[model samples]
Target: MNVTLTLALFIAAWALLDYLKPQFVANLEDNILSFLLAIITLVSFGQVVARYGFNTGWSAALEFNMLAFSWLILFGMSYGIRTRLHLGVDILLQKVGPQTAKMLGIFGGLLGAFYALIILDGAVLSIVGVDKEGGAITYFAKMYKVGIGVEEMKYPAFVQEMFGLKRPHVQRWVVLLILPISLGLLAYRCLQASWHIYTGQCGSLIAGHEAESLVEENRGALKD
Candidate 1:
């Protein structure tokens, strides 16, 4: 689990660096979420076909798919913030001048950052668990002391033997840590969006409505 967290942190750092580069186009969250969705779809469809057509299916398929689905939704929230895909009513913002709008957008981002911070704090508490001595347990302490595992999955026997692995089941706490991680990501994105808005690098905190833009485009076409 420590190794998993380290790897995740490394990937996140790389993603942040890539985001800072002007020419970088690939989105780490988008790529990961897309890959997860693809795997889930394939596994689900295969399971259905096997169960109905071949009268046999892997028992772990549903659990694995559900795990992947959970990760997708959890991570997608921050991705939505990064891409400005989340819906927001901007009627008042639209009426404001550019400078005022930018200020308001920054304030909105601060509010979002605060919200994410609260969620992150709660998630951290869950990940850490409570100590028997009525003290707060750190996530690092919990990771080392806890030996919880997922029930439906196991590593292949050959690979397990080769790696000299003791536990057959996947660790559940590692997956659960995504709660804090995703909330942290959401907070980071909120601050980043606010910074970009302040610097005039982006237009607003919320994305423009696609339907309204399409309608306006069609109206101009009709006039011309």
Candidate 2:
């Protein structure tokens, strides 16, 4: 598997262990995953420092890292909403029996699947647009002025123009791929949730009705 899929599977495994085992081994695995994530983040920071230099200091680094982190959270929440893991009123859901709850869950998953499919289509179109543009935003005249009199040595004048403008080439392309990939993942998660719901495993696959009941029951006992 690619590194991204491997990390995604590792996260699912951690989520599984957290739900099923929730014991020492799972806790240890969680800690190991956390450590690996931290190490990878640090390595990413090192790469940035090596490429961008430390001349910009901590504030710039913090701003850059915060932007990346914000994207991560934004994608995660997008996926969470598709999976119905975003907050909702569960009191009514729990008041109904498992059959009704499961049906509602299935309905929710179907709705999410429809939404994810729309996002997936949009993502594909966006990727196609990027491909058509060759990942560059160049006007025809802007593309014409960059050559130093070398025949057939034309280039998109962005690099030169950015240098002229004293602006940085902040390679936002890597981040551009984020949305499509996240949408694809979100679609997969919705399908997974749908499968679990159909197979009567949604209640166990996620901490849903059972968790709400436990919390409510605990709160009532405390009141008593």
Candidate 3:
């Protein structure tokens, strides 16, 4: 058994667990975000200290930090929706009655899903080059065949040999895969919110602090 391939397969197993247990997936996303954040902070701090105090730093530090930031933002987009952390302007929603607000929220969810679908389509097309014959092919396959690699921080020779890779550099396609994954997650959450609203399990698709709370607080302040 190839140890490298086995390690990759083990990592991929998390996707299966995501489908089987959504809560597990949610926790996984949170943990991944936290780890990325920590890495970014530590690396950036080290880079600063090395540049100023030691008069030296890793040349690839900026590139690695950028990659980490991109991953965090992309993954956090879906996590925000899942945890109802996304801010929404709900003035109109609050003005309406419960039934009307719920219906409008469902409509908004559909629109969000549609927007994500459009983004996903464009990203996929960009990643996978089109054939002259107008045939479509998988981007991952093309990337693998070409052995594309990142400009900086190439993988070690041993890792390349273990994976039978022609290039020692990190694969660009692997990072690009986050585009589809995050978009898919966002679309799924949009549909989920719509369903919840339809079933009366959720009052609104846009989650935020209720307007009534602000009004109540203001009234209490006036009395005081």
Candidate 4:
């Protein structure tokens, strides 16, 4: 199925990136997050101005924003892991010595990767599927086949005039298609971080120390 192929291709891409790590692959998540945030901010600002000033606004604005926000959260998780921006208590890590703490952090990273993959098992079977009917992953393919659309954002009359048939709205499958990819990417990031920790290429999985440094950098301004 399409879902299975996509996951497989993603796995291959991950390996390729490890060797090559071209800039585009490295920043793909960052680009996506920036785009989603930009559009969401613009649309929200426009909607408020239109509603209050003109008493009319895009009805689909709210629906669009919700989808964009969901997308932001999904992709942001992987980005956080990739950038080591995710926070952890690190109290136990501190108590341990440097060598022991490094091992513990690496262990936590591997566990994080496994957790992401396992969470997908309910919606997906092994990122592959139990069968057509057994996995929710297949539901995306079915939705695409049936050409189902979101409730809001119907196609305009111009689209019907040109195509000779009206589509209901933007397709749900297209919007939600990021779910599986985001989950897969989260697993990749966790494993990648774990490897870096083990190899001494990076420090803790948690950003606590980085966060402390950032706050210290701003403390003088805050005091002013």
Whose lDDT is greatest here? 4
Clashing pairs in 4: none
Off by over 4 Å in 4: 123-136, 156-166, 213-224
Task: Assess every candidate by TM-score.
Answer: 0.76, 0.47, 0.73, 0.82
- CA lDDT of each prediction against the hidden true structure: 0.73, 0.52, 0.70, 0.79
Best by TM-score: 4
lDDT of 2: 0.52
Clashing pairs in 2: none
Model 1 over residues 1-224: C-alpha lDDT tens digits?
45336634854785578578624534556678889999999999999999999999998898898888988887887787777888888888889897898899999888887777555443433534732231111353375468677888887899789999899887776566566667667777888889989998877777665447767879978788
Q: Which ranges in model 3 have alpha carbons more than 4 Å from their true place? A: 1-20, 122-145, 211-224
lDDT of 1 at 93: 82
Q: Whole-model lDDT for model 4 versus the true structure?
A: 0.79
lDDT of 2 at 177: 43
**Candidate with more favorable, higher lDDT: 3 or 4:** 4
Cα deviation in Å at residue 17, candidate 2? 18
Q: Per-candidate RMSD vs. true structure?
A: 5.5, 11.8, 6.8, 3.9
Q: How many clashing residue pairs appear in each of the predictions shown?
A: 0, 0, 0, 0
